[model samples]
Target chain A: MDDLDLDHESVYDGLLGGDSSQWAFGTDFEDPLAGVDTMIPAGVDGAALAAYCLMLGDDALIYAHRLSEWTSNAPDLEDDIALANIALDLLGQARLLLARAAAADASVVPQMPEGSPVPPEDALAFFRDEHAFRNMGYVEALNGDFAVTIVRLLLFSSHRLALLQRLATSVDPVLSAIAAKGVKEVTYHRDYAGRWFVTLAGGTEESRRRLVAGLRTVWPTYAELSRSTQVETLASEQRFGVDPAVLTEEVDAVVDHVLAMAALERPDLPPSGTGPMGRIGRHTEEMGHLLAEMQVVARAHPLGKW
Target chain B: MTTLAAGRTRAREIAGTVVDPEMPMLTLVDLGVLRDVTESEVGVSVTITPTYSGCPAMATMRDDLVHALSDAGYAEVEVKVSLSPAWSSDWITAEGRRKLRAHGLSAPGPSPTGPVQLSLAPVRRAIDCPRCGSADVRLTSEFGPTACKALYQCNDCLEPFEHVKEI
Candidate 1:
């Protein structure tokens, strides 16, 4: 009953504690690795594997957040549901990836009570500092128009589809398993966004202009595909990851084909936050703000079960 | 009584009775989401696969499986998820298709195989309406309420129906 404790920022300090979801069993649900093998493939450095997983997880996490924003805001109900469904698919991928990371390197997970219902996936998602996130510039960017979402999603999924396809044969059983499922999901995602990209480009002149502008804004994310980070290189060397170099040709073919069909010109622009920028703990101001909103409730009640 | 015993084993029968949370008309077994049920020395374990990666229903299915088995005189019940060989729409049982049609939702056709090739147009499929059996159904959206379905409007019946889209 700390009435007039106006300086306190913790929401859970109040009489009601917090929402039902903050309780462990509500949305936090069960373990992502319920029955899967948690063993790290031999010879693979656990920490390195964890970092790789975080990169993939963070990309999905941030992009899903951006896509979820379109829920009530899309032009049509079907498009709204379509975007939301795609976001849900990415969110599921993030959950499994984050859980895999926590399983590989326990040191990275935030400490929690024994037998706590709050899953490790939630812990990594909620407790990590903004600088700890490893998502790319494309995923962390603020939403533009609906066309921008389509452009960005198309590029991300095109590259991701290629990468995941390669990862399906990984030596790590868990990563391979996750990738096998992910390939199927991202295929639909790439197709959805690719179709939308074509539609918008061929639609009204205004929509065409918006899509071009959207492409320019998210071009940095696609450009980053040309550079391979150290972890990615190492992981690829170990047979559990794909080098960014290899994805370039296939991704280019897919994107170029889509753009050609739409009669849209490729934006000639410099890549922002190039090389190891986002994945190496460096990010734009957008990421900090996004993490702030996404983690606010969970961070406020770190021990709040749900 | 003796004749009925020729059906599926008790554990599987009970587990299969659990319905899908998103589509209640179809049981887990009918949808082919239920992969396996095996009895070991430890207990009876059930295996299920997700129709979509981000499917929220997977958790419910696992919980339902555990509850169904636990109530069926098995002390220990475990549910496992397998992601390999990814679940396909073609896996839907024949009975599952019958149940779906009976419930007015069009069942999925064959799933696309081979490497994914980008298609610019919205997905085109040869779907017949479950209600009126009309072949002239237009796709309203490639995605529906859940990840596994698509929204369609039958030209003949003029009623909106959901089709479990082929993966």
Candidate 2:
């Protein structure tokens, strides 16, 4: 009936573990994705691709984290599992991207000599400074209404699917393979979110208003996604990346179609010029808070295995 | 090859009953994430690719697999996680689909073939009504309660249903 009752009830139901005496959550020390191999594309600038993939990866990672926060808080039990599974799909993509970026040729490390060695997970978890991160602002923003979260997924997945579809044809085999796998999942995410937008917008008066408000909140951040950049140029030249500018037509078509179907008024938000420049070393305060929670358990007992 | 041969046979049997922690009606083997199982000199190793990176149940699934193996007296088990070859719902077996339908959920449709051709994207394929085996159905919502399914309403059966997407 109360807050603790709802929060702890699931844990107490022996769902997670038997007793409170040794109730340990998450990982103790062993890396779940350890022993996995990552294959960076050959002939491409690993640094540029790593940075670009990190941007996409971080977007999925942060948003997936946010979505998981909705567990048990959703409107129904089935919905809770649904959101959690969607979060998992994104999380899976993020993991692969991060792994690929981190495993780039030692050459991607600016200071590393040709023969120098780097542990993959260390390269992934510890090496990248804040200035090196490339995730767009759309993902790290605080949670809005459920409708808004669905809308955000819809928009982001649309863009990602476009990018992944192009990547599927990359000169690089590994990138092509990863893209092949990713495109399928993003398609589902986009379609699922689109369905929600239609229902909420067409369902009822209150639902329609909330759905519109959710769109406005996420629209401002959407601009940065389409902004042009040299990183995109590097990937495009290598024939291993999708150009942000090229994605515009695709992005616009989908967004316009979804909005009209929902019968929602589009926000006249100005396109953001702030661009990928800020994501390099700068970020919203939210990133720091998120990293703190995520890093704490891992850092606390480094190497302790469950 | 011998250990792998033996391990595969055992794994096929064990995984058949290892139901998805979330869906419960489907097994990880049916989902196709359980790639291989090998009996190493140290122990038996089970290789699995996660359907989602942050899937909370992954830890539970790992523990459950170990428990199931150990209970069967295959001690010294090691679970290896693989990510490169990502999971797709297309990997789900036909039997899995039937199980899902019997459990009152629609099965995944076939994967889209040929180029994506966005304008010609597949829509509203034949979905057997999970409740009454009716063929008449209409999609109520693309987004279902979960990420894997779409909400549909069966016209003949007059029941709303969840249809899994074939990724």
Candidate 3:
């Protein structure tokens, strides 16, 4: 029999060529933005641009961490694999954005010890305190039931899809390239969550009730996602960033259509304060727990090799 | 031909023939991922792009290129990854499309020229079954067993196959 004739049990087995030792989730890393001209655009504030990228990067990093929590806990096998793939995509985006932020301004990267081998992205992800993260509350909030996860994914993906589309045209080449690739990935993410959202909402009595309850649980934090911060405002004015506020109309239109199709109502909920606290290193109580779990391994073994 | 030019051409041919470990149906050249190969005073430099950002096949591809070039008697081989002007599904060569279908995976349809429309459902493209060449097929899942393909079942043939996803 030929070497390729070996019966493979899964796609990964085939993809890895029957040897899993060389394959790793994040270990075999290559610079995603390599060979791209990362020069900051003329007339843009380097510090503000880096800060803006931190916000975007932190959002993806935290949400990816939350999604990874579903690895062995997803409702089914397919959902398990799907959520893992989605998390990896977000992780890839976070890496690129964080790397870009460091390139734009090294000051934003957390201080690493001399001769430490940790990359800038890893440093930011593992070294930062809870109060240093800029992710919106929606991502850092504790995951509830399956319905709540679906609701959160739907809302986050929709908003992110709109924002990435606009950022695809940024004057900065690195940001534009990242957004160009992100647009496709986020489109799939939004569609995946939307499909699940409709399925549960239209499935049965229990599912419908859970879906409604999930919507109510997450609705209060929705306003925080679109609130623009001073750094974002400055970057947007300079065309280096897309203001989150500008994405509201597009986000609402997509969400409204989906809700109407699913026969679900837009939960009437009060906004959770109109502050840019999240962007300025203030986060929910859950953020501390999330960071503690995420940073434990790295903190215990600084410069550890996987 | 000069010795340098001949070495460069030979290196390109060796690198271009390295098969993608994941797909196995297409080589680097067929997929348009091998962007360019150049000869410098130091050695041969090969450039490639990834089909997806998180694609695990890139590391294998790079290693394969370096090994193949070294086996061809080229020294100081360098492989570089490029992301600007990111890869598109449209870059898959016509020959690559035929090979994918022969391997029981439907080739990706032409990518939409306009911007992607944000909708509730995934934008479904009409894909013929690779097994029966039947147009009667339905997407079973947006994601297939791998990141680059989607699962589809052919109603006419009653067989399930993978379709290379349009990015």
**Deviation of model 3 at B44, angstroms:** 2.4
Query: Against the hidden reference, what TM-scores do the models get?
Result: 0.91, 0.71, 0.89
TM-score of chain B of each: 0.92, 0.82, 0.94
Off by over 4 Å in 2: A1-39, A71-82, A105-132, A146-151, A203-217, A263-266, A293-306, B1-29, B34-88, B101-105, B114-163
Q: Quote the positional error of residue A113 for candidate 3 in Å.
A: 3.3
lDDT by residue (A126-234, candidate 3, tens digit) is 9988887888877988789889999999999999988988998898888988888888888788888998998898889999999999999998888888999888889
Give the backbone clash total of model 2. 4
Q: Give the better candidate number (1 or 2) by DockQ.
A: 1
Docking class of 2: acceptable
Best by TM-score: 1
- State residue A275's C-alpha deviation in candidate 3, in Å: 1.3
- As a whole number from 0 to 100, the lDDT of residue A79 in candidate 2 is 60
DockQ: which candidate is best?
1
DockQ of 3: 0.39
> Every model's DockQ, to 2 decimals?
0.46, 0.36, 0.39
lDDT of 2 by residue, B1-167 (tens): 87667876786578556767767888887777788777765567888776654555666667677777776767687877765566677888888877898889988877676755333122566877889988988866555654566778889868988888766
List clashing residue pairs in candidate 3: none
